[model samples]
Target: MKKLMMICMSLLMVIGLVACDDDTEGMKKVGIIQYAQHPALDQAHDGFIDALKDEGFEEGKNITFDDQNAQGEGSNAETIADKLVNDGNDLIYAIATPSAIAAAQKTTEIPIVISAVTNPEDSKLVKSNEKPGGNVTGVSDLTPVEDQIDLLVKLAPEVKSVAVMYTNAERNSELQYEIAKKALEAKGIKVEAATVSESNQVQQVAESLVGKVDAIYVPTDNMVSESIANVVSVTNEHNMPTIVGEIAMVEKGALATYGINYYDIGYLAGKQAAKILRGEAEPKDMPIEYSSEDKLEMGFNESTAKKLGITIPEELLKEAKIVK
Candidate 1:
């Protein structure tokens, strides 16, 4: 009789475990990986979470998230992707080009959503933007680089030479550098470029541009964006006027940029994620979205301009967003 009771107790324990497993069957798991910490990327991540909530996937209820930040390391990004995919995450949101590519490389079966990538095709993270042709699709923070350079020219009319600095390892920054170089050259301005592979080199690179160029320009580079304060430190000491690809950089001391709203792009990516989670769409069928042209806006930092001894035109200041 005692042996019989032991068997019944073991069976009851198994039933209890099975019931607990069944209770979680209704919840969805999402894995999010960010390339680094910066205002633009943070805004994108926040927007994505908010949009997911808007789509009825509330945190701590129907959905759970495994969020990881790569801290600007490619190897770390790959490891994070592997853990998220191998651990059976239902979806992945990659917050930058490197993070997106890492997630894409980790699994083809898991639905992967990307945000803040400039050229998805050029990065080879997707087959095409219109139709992903694979398990990766989302939003692009493709700011108008040419228009930004035009605004920079107008902001610094007497600038005859400009230095473009970016992380050499990031193709997104390289693409912007090419555009900035071409635009400045077309206007009879000499263009110089400095490339850094990581954050430690940003100060050296920014210092290299001092006394060599009339102004400095930076694109939406993950590495550079992550270490922009260091760049600003060097540039500010030299009284160099710097233009950037995003408004957040203006707050960090870049003189100006006419850029896209990163938050909106991330929210759009979350919408695509919601559709996939709801069984209404697939990543392969989702077309990547570009930040609308209407969302592009001008920005400038008065403090940085003042330190650089650059005068902002009253008209430009009136229309552009002031970065405090």
Candidate 2:
């Protein structure tokens, strides 16, 4: 009788544990914090949602999303991150470095899947890229800066000197600028640089580079990308060819770039989020992912090319996506 009672109790405990697992069919809550409203970040956010849908976590059916935007403010990102953590989110998808840093700071318990962050370790969101060692893991949007510099030279052989403009506060932009500077110098191209602390200062800073350099190279800095029209206004008037860090920036009027697709990286991050939500994986165990180089695209601006009176190489034109 005693043995039968113990066996019955063990069976009941096992049933309760299985029932408590996250694999059970239940509604999940996901919080998304986007750092800004630019095209790249917007596409990332959209792709993240699409990936969740494909993973059987459709909004309003199995999952509910608490989407918040920081509007390019660090304080706002922190506030939103706090709210999401307090709300008991099943998982958090942070778009951009600022938002990811905010979410990682808010809670170490909640699973965090980040996108658009250039360096997770440098940003202190993860201990390392291979093994995150914490509750954060996602994709990095580290575009090929060396190849991009080479592309700039190919498009405009006359560019002997270039201006590198970026936002000072963005760590990702700062890192890319350092890499770009080295690459430019290696090709015997002189490099001038400028930094903007805010969007309102972009035009003035861009104007400062007018007579100093032959062309401009802008990285995937959120603040600079948001105010890209201002930079282009100056470049267009000067007939200067600008090489940007990503395709969206090319679409915004920069000359060209060998950049990764923000949507693809975001989709990869979303899949990580899905695994966490279903209790199939833990953030610390998942290795950080990157968009495959084969997925990189050469993007050029048609109108900008014509405006600058630059001739496109037949080989490049054959493989590039011409954005008018």
Q: Model 1, range 61-178, lDDT digits (tens) per residue? A: 7899999999888899999999999989999999999899899888999999999999888899889878889999999888888988888888788899988888787888888999
Model 1: lDDT to the true structure = 0.89
Top-scoring candidate (lDDT): 2
Error of 1 at 19 (Å): 9.6
Show model 1 residue runs off by greater than 4 Å.
Answer: 1-23
Q: Residue 69 lDDT in model 2?
A: 96
| Cα lDDT listed for each candidate | 0.89, 0.91
| TM-scores vs. true structure, each candidate | 0.91, 0.92
Error of 2 at 301 (Å): 1.1
Q: Residue 90 deviation, candidate 2, in Å?
A: 0.6
Give the range where candidate 1 is weakest over 10 consecutive residues by summed lDDT: 315-324
Candidate 2: minimum summed lDDT over ten consecutive residues — where? 18-27
Q: In model 2, what lDDT does residue 303 have?
A: 94
